[model samples]
Target: MYTLLIVDDESIAVRGMKQGIVWSDLAITEILEAYNVKQAKQLFANHQIDIMICDIEMPGQNGIELLEWTRTHYPDTVSLFLTAHADFTYVQKALQLGSFDYILKPVKHEQLKDITGQAVLQWKKNEEKKTFSVLHKQYVQQWEEQLPHLIERFWQELLGERVLPKSKQIAAKLQQLNIPLTLDDQVLPILISIEMWKEEFNARDEEIMEYALRKTASELMLASWPGTVIQDRNGINLLLIYVKPTDPIIRDEVQKICEEYIRYCNQYFKCSLSCYIGESTKITEIPGMYSDLLVMERNNVSASNKVILANEQLQVRPFFDSSATSFPVMDWIMLFELGRKEELLEQMTESCTYMEQKSGFCKEDLESMHTSILFLLFSVFHKKGLSVYEAFPSKQLIDSTINIRTLEQFRTWMYKVISQGIGHFMLHAKEESEIVIKTKKYISEHIHQEFSREDIASYVFLNPSYLSRLFKKETGISLTDYILKERMNEAKRLLVQTEMKISQIAESLGYMNLSHFITMFKKVNGATPMNFRKKIQ
Candidate 1:
């Protein structure tokens, strides 16, 4: 329901408008009448007037003056002017006073009703916008309260590769999140690896202790510095320290802080920790440095509760040299090819134990061993007339092999890949035989239709690349070449057996363009389609 006010000096005009016009259809429940601006002001002060229809030439205070007052006091109230005169000056004055609309006197009832209806809609829209503004402010306040947690989540995504490492993108995000450091700043990465807890703890207790550890690290290690501490996906705590360019003593200060943190953890928390401090680099290089620290932590085989700098780890040769007797690569490959699963796994375990005992393996040795093992597997699979890609379709064999960083990761990846390969080889061998049979049947059935490797693979429910590899492995020819061979064979048969024209035969083989078909036939048969048909006939 809405209240409407009519201000005019003429009583008859106000009466006719109130009684003659059907106010109920416009949702105006109550109509308030006023003879002058003073009476209109009193009515407006008493009631919540949604719309005001005032005569422009009222006595004493005019409609323009009333509209001006309402514009300041009741800004949400929509106002319109009704005048008996078509004076351009009055319309100009009314419009300048912020009147919603102006209507000349001797008004039509329909036109007046239409203008009032629009005014009512405008009022409702204004109210709705006000409500939305309030809610929007409330929501923005809530987001501001959670800004810190959101910033931490963004950092976690940055380290986890969910966010790309572009400097401009990272800098813009930092500014938007109001982070104190910039990409141009030098940052040191500190990786804290928790070895063991002296006492037993439940999951909830462990979470609380981890939070306490982060707070302690920030308080002690970064008390005089600016830094951020985040727990990564591996549950390892890392601190990114920001330092001034002229601060030459910052490293020594940070080292002493880390030592104190280690001592405090062992004493109060009953947990042993090994700290891996990375070299200071720019913000964009932090991800690489973080990866290096992860590798160092995984490769640590020394005593716990110590600080290990990345440079020191790089200088020392902890694992055996590659020239030493590592693992029997050929023997392992032979066992794998022979399908001796138990013996193969045992041999792998024994080799890993021996490498751990020797304990001086470097990055190059790990990569070399990875390459050797992959080469051995590829050879065994090749000898068995199977492609590794066809045997294991889901695994990215090349990329995963290249990304092997530590000896432990290499060992785990090798064991998993070999084990999965052995299982898939047996299954895929039979599957590929069935696929080849089905593929041949499909090709022969659809020989007259335009189809591709994707269509054939879709029919057999296999990936196109995988199916192509399987077809080539079994048929000694690529899928495209084989399709062309089948099409040419059919063309020859049609030319020799049927009395169809060369164009008709080409169209029957799904070649919409006759020239393309002739070109292909010439390339394959060393003659045009008509030439081949005439020679055969």
Candidate 2:
């Protein structure tokens, strides 16, 4: 409801408005009458006045002075000026002082009524927003002061250090504060966190970033959960979502919304976004589930900004075989160095295909893959005497990190980076050859050491998927298959030339179990270890 304050020294004009205008029809709840500026200020101080309709000429304090004071102090209050004088100077001053409108003394009741109604409607909107903010602030404070203790108890019960009764007690206290939850009821919360772009933004900017993210999250929560999204708090905006039959669908909707929002931020705001979805459990279980989500997201820095459900699959697996497949890592390096952007983009389709295949990777694996690729690219850039920042820059780094949120984003970023400076990038292709050679050397030596495909990764420090693909591209053999073949040949040599027992040879070759050794040997050589030994002899 909007409250209007009418200030006029002329009694006749004030009576005319009160009698001629339908205040109720205009939706003005309280029509406060003030004879002078002092009385109007007193009313403003005491009550919530949305609009002030005052006479420009008044005793002691004039409407101009009153409007100026309201402009500074009661900025939320819309000011409307009234005066018998049709002075252009007064009209100009009123306009300059931020008055909503200035009406001459012989005010037309119809015009005055219509303008007041419009002002009232606008004021109501502003008032509602103000009311919500006040409520949000009050509750946010309550949650902040109490959440730490509640979370501590929640953890204790989750870890079995405390009992259910304690958890119930904490839930009861939250209910007392009108948060409205019980130990029996489940609470599903989406965990939102920001990954700073290497501290480039200052404190104020970071605060603004958090605020923007919170607003976006809040809007998404409203869209997805409607009334169930009670309140949000801190930099980590936890939306108190109600778990229902359509929850998975609801969560998916929320995830889609957040992904778009995060993409916008990356494209327009340049902030790194990461989100973790927690399971729907009893409200008391939120802390435990959230802790797990945080740990999962922390251990995996390359996750997307989408809301992840608690029980959702999250692992680091090979989503793309860079050796068997093609990615634009090389093309991008070449383009970035040579500045052949047009040609680089022309080669982007293949690279995008590889990144799109990364959808099969769990959130954790996707993030790890992102990290590994960045490190490798940085290394490649540094080896070629190019600055990592100069070639890729911080913004690109953030985009690449956030790009894994979706296959499309990944592809988009890959294309954008690949199409940078193609001709200039060819120079860095020198390291590609060296990286391939180093990878083979490491594998040849470490083949006898039970070297898994991933273990061969330390040689070039690329991701296992990337190295696996790179080796096959260069040597036409998978790293693991190559390692297995080498190990079998070494075993056959030991079996024939050295009087080494099968068990001894197995232990020497980093196999702990004799049966396991025989299985692997037969799998590779098409014969049992003993048979191979006899045949070799």
**Evaluated with TM-score, which candidate comes out highest?**
1
Per-residue C-alpha lDDT of model 1 across residues 269-385, encoded as one tens digit per residue: 988777889999877766667766764664454446888887664332222222233566556655776677778878776766666577666766566666666665665564344
Give the best candidate by lDDT: 1
lDDT per residue (tens digit) for residues 1-537 in model 2? 668888999888788888888888877777889999898888888998888898989889898999998988888998888878789999999998877787876899999988887787777788799999999999999888987556534433443322235665766665654544455556666666554332233334555766676666666555655323222222234555655444433456666766776777677666556666666767555555655554344334234455555666555422222222234354344345556566655555544455557555355645544554564356445334345565567878656665457656665666555544233346555444555667667866765575554445444544343444445565666455566676778888888888888999989888888988898888778999888867766
Question: In candidate 2, which residue ranges exceed 4 Å CA deviation?
Answer: 1-165, 226-237, 244-249, 304-309, 312-537
Model 1 scores a C-alpha lDDT of 0.76
Q: Give the TM-scores of the predictions, in the order they appear.
A: 0.48, 0.29
